[model samples]
Target: MRSNASDCDVLIVGAGIAGISMAAHLQDKCANLSFMMVERRAQPGGTWDLFRYPGVRSDSDMQTLGFAFEPWDDDQSIAPGGSILEYLRGVIHKRGIADHIRTSTTVISADWQGDQACWLVSVEGPDGPEKVRARWLYMSTGYYDYDHPYDAQITGLESFAGTLVHPQFWPENLDYADKRVVVIGSGATAVTLVPAMAEQAGHVTMLQRTPTWMSVGPSRDRLARVLRRILPRKLAYWLVRQRNIRLFDFLYHAARRNPHMAAEKLSEGVRKELGDLYSPEDFTPPYNPWEQRLCLVPDSDLFKSIRQGKASIVTAKIDTVQTDGIALEGGEVLPADIIVTATGLKLSLGGHIKVSIEGRPVNWGEEFFYRGCMISNVPNLTFVFGYLNASFTLRADNTAAYSCRVLNHLRTSGTQIAIARPPADGLVEGEPFPFSSGYLMRDLAQVPKSTDALPWRLNHDYLADCRDFRRNGVDDGHLQFELAPRVTDQSPVADQPEMA
Candidate 1:
């Protein structure tokens, strides 16, 4: 048992993109606030560090994916995982916030005391089990669990003779040279793995239960490059970012409003790129576009692999896994030296940290999301949840800026705690995410929901979110503020060993 002398006004969980962005935004706008960042992983890069699979890259362009305060001056707009990790490390060093971070520190639980107006955060640090006090709590932990991934649960998987791998935990010494690989699922991971492994492998087959819509574009943004040559750096970056945002909005609206026309346009584009090798039925998905995330392939690499006969796509159901390969329901067997499962991620909230308010555990599922940042009836705590439609950083940036505003308001009003309250009229119920991604659907019940009312419904549209989070004031009737009640210091935490 150790006492933490370095108390903080705010204790932030996870030192990833969202956490770093939050720190930067607060520093630029609210430098006086004392905050500390804690990460369970030894490194700062979140997804970028975790995923080391072949051809791992961002689905969204770097112009939007990169922090708003920092310009992404990289050569490729669809950056590789290594480059993104490097960029995140550079930001932490450049900002001089490295010392403020405690790596390999996992938060086990947080208990909010209304009387003291502080949260007793139980964390496992390098030394041992420790207790830290913070006036407020901020969660930058991403939606997915780092320690566990979703299990596909295929029958007789252990009987397979081939090497089994998941993209979430790619082996460091993995070699695929001259190997016949079969990748399961048709999402972004499968598309990326197929093209990349095809380069060295004897052949690669993509087996999917259902096809996903894919879009191919140049890895480098030619317009951004041209603009940089003619205009100032800041101006060029702004223009490029805005252009991509508008284009994403237009395409999403088109897909939602006119599914048939949108499908026709997407199919025509893919058909022209692949020529006779592509079939509309095989490439087309049953659901409308944007129903699930659209996979992006850089420079038609996937199509190139298929055209060269290095890779092929098969839609089938797995009856069982044989010693040699997977047997299909349609009486076909796929022979493979290796099998990769790119199924999906397992969603986690607040890094699975248990939260209690005055001895009662928080029911996150029953709570309403207030501005997609703070949970309803939860005091002085905020979680950063991004937009699924646009680049995640866009919403992350907005959430950070909005949080800064709320913090400033609290300071001005001399309030130690603030909670989101339901209005006199009840909120209309709706799904947490408008989209139907498998991961989202599987964990929808556990997540917090938003309503149709203002400051409650999280519209994925970037422009609307920007206006609401940035321009709108925080003193709306939804958030109820209060000062702390007079109380003595908190009791000592129980003596326990640090989590191994």
Candidate 2:
């Protein structure tokens, strides 16, 4: 298609936070080894770049959302999409990781060649299909797919006359100002959108099938700003990062351990903030605060919007979509000039990419999740999965660090392929990993279910898992030190070669 497909020491898929962090860690630790990162998008910053909806901000604070090596310098704790994208771009440029990334290159399929002890990767690019062989394949493709949208089939959605938009594919030019906007869904996207659009929209209605626990905090951290002004930039960054980490950890742990008390406190807090304007019955979720993610309402902005009569909450199931508005199942029709589906996304493991070993298909559904990083039978592959309790980046950083350790171990032991095996006593099968219904139920038909071994377990207790993963090889057990002949070294390639 273009030129001869070149080989690499490691092949990384996805140029998102996970892939970028992995590449950075590998480059910093193993400078002698050459690796290439393949990203399907034209640029980096996967989710941040893709979702450009109004009021789209990180659910986690910016300090924690950012890479460990890079600290977010923005004044706001909950940074917007544009700021996060810029920060990621800055990190890539600062680290010079752009050189190692092959943009607009998609890995179609990967097959492990047992005899050669290498992975044969077939990729599609702008020019044509190309193939490469790598001793190690690291699937840093984030859990969710870029183009997939979770749109529930509404009965009369097609018949609606007004513009209907999904937060996933928000139109850049659509004007919400002076329009009676109705946002559907009760997740983070809807929470964020309702408040933001309410500021300008003629009237904004938050239409929710179910309520989600929403908590309010100051968008700008005053202490963080003060420290930034007084202390050195690096020191300020470290202090704020540590403080937020501890705070979030405590909150999440409390909620998980004492659900009843936590739920009461969260509900009381919301009631006090919104007073009579926010109906506790309609706004408060039945589940515990952290059972599902607690929606962050910066500075009680959403409540303020409600107080000002700019926004209203409507909890009802949509029976049908009328040409002028949405009809509730209870026979009430609400008028709206525009409808925004702030619905969640489809959960796809490894971007729905195909994986096979020695010509046999690897059924991910049947596979075990080993330490939430590697698949049971998947050899020489490590994925980037973050903590469910704390900020995802914190866990991602730990994953990157542990991956480095694993790589070093492999190099020292002359192990070309290492696969993690479940416990012999079958403890892995007995204790399936716990996950939220959103992920488990949303894509049940598509993704594999977590069995006892190699199950999808999210470690909310951040430090414990971080220490365990970093020090311990694998939680249950790992098939370590599978030796193979080394690949023949080719000519040293230039760092910044143009992508074919």
Candidate 3:
């Protein structure tokens, strides 16, 4: 081990939206606190850098997707993938965030030492394995696995002659122009890929085992454009952000309250766009709206492609992967030059980094989510998990703000740790996530549940969280703050182990 090792007051894992937001917030709110961000990848942009698939874009609007402190001045509300990546990079450079980032550093495990009241994070950096000690640990790693996408098992895939591609690891030089492309999946990736690939591919076919509800709307935000023209830039951005927030909340709530009406409205829009091409059997999903996230298409691009005969949707089960294309259950064959599996991502927390206290492994599923940020009984740690019903950044920003408050409280109280102590009465168990999205459903067992009470429950309402995070105090009774006893000169050397 090196004589000198990196240590910080706070160690943030993952340099994605959450990590960047937390770092920026800590810098602004707790300027005196030393912190560093360790990202597994070589770059700062997490999702934007990871997914290089064609037609890759945010399912949510940029007004809400962009950081709260940073105003998105772009005319288009649904910005392209490249624009989002640029925005993330711009924030890092503009705020001098890169100085605190250690890219290509993967955190393998984090062990919290009760004696030291600090976490020893094991990370594999470019120089090899190293130890980093921090007074507090912030896990900003998102809920998906970056190393591998969800692998869908298909029969006879090895015998297929066509090129197979997954959107997660798109090839730069792979040619699909003027070639038959078949996208297998009915999620956002499939919806986005079919339309984008149709522009150049000879023809694109979306083969789905089940239908997913998709909403079509304009790419540009009319309200944002008008507000920008009439109002100051900051004011306009705030108004648009709030406007979109309310709009999304209302839509999601309405969908849950009245699925039949929501389904009709969603199906009607698709029918109107496709006209004769629309099939109720294919467009109408078995599940209600908001059961899974509604895929948003900008400018009706997917529908336009369908109408132009460049793209088509097929609702069927794949029986086998033929040499040239896919064979359906009923013996229907769809010839393809390339098969793109737009299957969803594999869900993982903290990029699959193992967390422990001493030597005992932490089972996240047993703990309650404290304020949707900190885990119950976990000291000096917070996770940035976004909302399922609204823009992800809404929750991201709130989590960062709340984390800053917690840090400030710990400093003021002369405490080294702040852990949530469950009430005498046990918490009421609830689902980890509100929605039943395939990704969440597939990995539900791994996620922790939320309690029924305040400061522990996963409140999906962003407005509630926004107000609570901004106006609420950090010394809530649920959180117990403590200062670890100082080590005396006569203390045994083995009592405090050396870092690796």
Where is the poorest 10-residue window by lDDT in model 1?
491-500
lDDT of 3 at 314: 95
lDDT by residue (tens digit), candidate 2, 175-285 = 888999999888889988988898789999998888988787888888888998999878888898888888888888777889888878878878888787757667777
How well does each candidate superpose onto the true structure, as a TM-score?
0.95, 0.92, 0.96
Give me the displacement of residue 327 in model 1, in angstroms: 0.5
lDDT of each: 0.86, 0.77, 0.87
RMSD of each: 4.4, 4.3, 3.1
Looking at model 3, report the run of 10 residues with the lowest lDDT sum.
491-500
Instruction: Write the candidate numbers in order of decreasing lDDT.
Output: 3, 1, 2
lDDT of 1 by residue, 305-394 (tens): 999999999988899988889999999999989999888888888889999998789988888898878998899899987788889898
* lDDT pick, better of 1 and 3: 3
Output the worst ten-in-a-row residue range by lDDT, candidate 2.
Answer: 491-500
The model with the greatest lDDT is: 3
Can you write out model 3's per-residue Cα lDDT over 349-414, one digit (the tens) per residue? Answer: 877888998878888878888888988878889988788877778888888888888888877665
What candidate 1 gets wrong by more than 4 Å, as runs, is 487-500
Clashing pairs in 3: none
TM-score of 3: 0.96
